[model samples]
Target: MDAGLKLRGIVAGYGQGDILRGLDLDVPAGQITCLIGPNGSGKSTVLRVISGLLAPRAGQVRLAGRNVTGWSPWAMLDGGVAHVPQERSLFPAMSVWDNVLMGAYINADRDAVARRATDIAQRFPLVARRRRDLAGSLSGGEQKTVEIARSMMLDPPVLCFDEPSIGLEPRARRTIFGILAELRRDGRTVLLVEQNARSGLAVADNGAVLDAGIVRLAAPASQLLDSPDVGRLYLGAS
Candidate 1:
């Protein structure tokens, strides 16, 4: 099967300075691909380029064999590529159920939206657990759970998550990884940028090491984790 998301020789940046140069990668379908790198290696930039938050100066981004480079964020979302950025993204005053439903805002069919919401709520019980509660009132971990549930409201084939486990306790981090594992079982392609290299690679099917704006290595997660050099340099010693 073709890789669900492909980036070839991509060059993207914020301004005059480029952060990602000649970056190439392929995220296989029905698997989780974790991206790990140092502080300035453009890990988050990769997600931004793929999700259309930033357009590349060159190269192409292909999703399911179709070139989608330079597409707008909204266009990318509509094209089955949903991005959950690094920051906290939720309406503080909205109810949990309402927040999840907000994800289907682009759809015009009320009945279809309601049906999808029902399915999502069933899949993520947290939505129902906090159905009537305000989003801001939930704990960080609970909020993250709601965010994941909201992202699924689109039912997209590919999901891009930027540090889904950031700013959480070990238990919460474990929950996020568990969610990623479940996503893979459901056949969704996941591109994840995680700072906790050890735990991230533990749940990932594949791992890519980014350095200085380029991919230095790409291999099976277990192989990368077992590599002494990789562990010493990036994985923080085995």
Candidate 2:
């Protein structure tokens, strides 16, 4: 696997409360890697650490093996890591097109931003159709789609999504996963932390079960999905 992001012996937490202990994981180039587990499993913390929202107490965070263990939040963005948090991140009063353009605020080039926005609109039709509607006017699923489209401003090589299907209905959940698959088809590394284990694993190239900040099991997503043990424990399947 071509390395897009790597975390080794990573320990992170909130205010002395350690959630992730010695967690090691990898996101290979052009693949979707899903992290699934029950609540309090430190799934979101891993995304936070990767995005530089929270610093890992120990261990290494590497981008293509560059050892970005302790880079600033802003630096990490410029380094090709884009994070889409579970919560809707758009400005409720703003237009969807504007919100998507904001993702490229770090880039000083308007032409480049415009070019990417065009690409994203073509990819995410909501952005094109709802170009003038207030972001808050969209449904939860539509808002989530816009959030993802916004996160692609830089065309980062790696994209990390936290609980992307959190508030979507069944049909919307299916659409969200479809979008994720499209991302993979475009050759982007996607590290998704999802509560919907079945949908997530179905689209993942690799899947890891995270518990108490540790990866309990890691394998090809399809294999893990087929494993009776995983299906019973994580999927609640008989």
**Candidate 2 C-alpha lDDT tens digits along 104-135:** 99999999899999999998988999999999
Q: Which segments of candidate 2 are over 4 A away from where they belong?
A: 1-3
Estimated TM-score for each candidate: 0.98, 0.97
Candidate 2: residue pairs that collide: none
Question: Per-residue lDDT of 39-79 in model 1, one digit per residue for the tens?
Answer: 99999999999999999999999998999999999999998
State the lDDT at 170 in candidate 1. Answer: 86
lDDT, candidates in the order shown: 0.92, 0.92
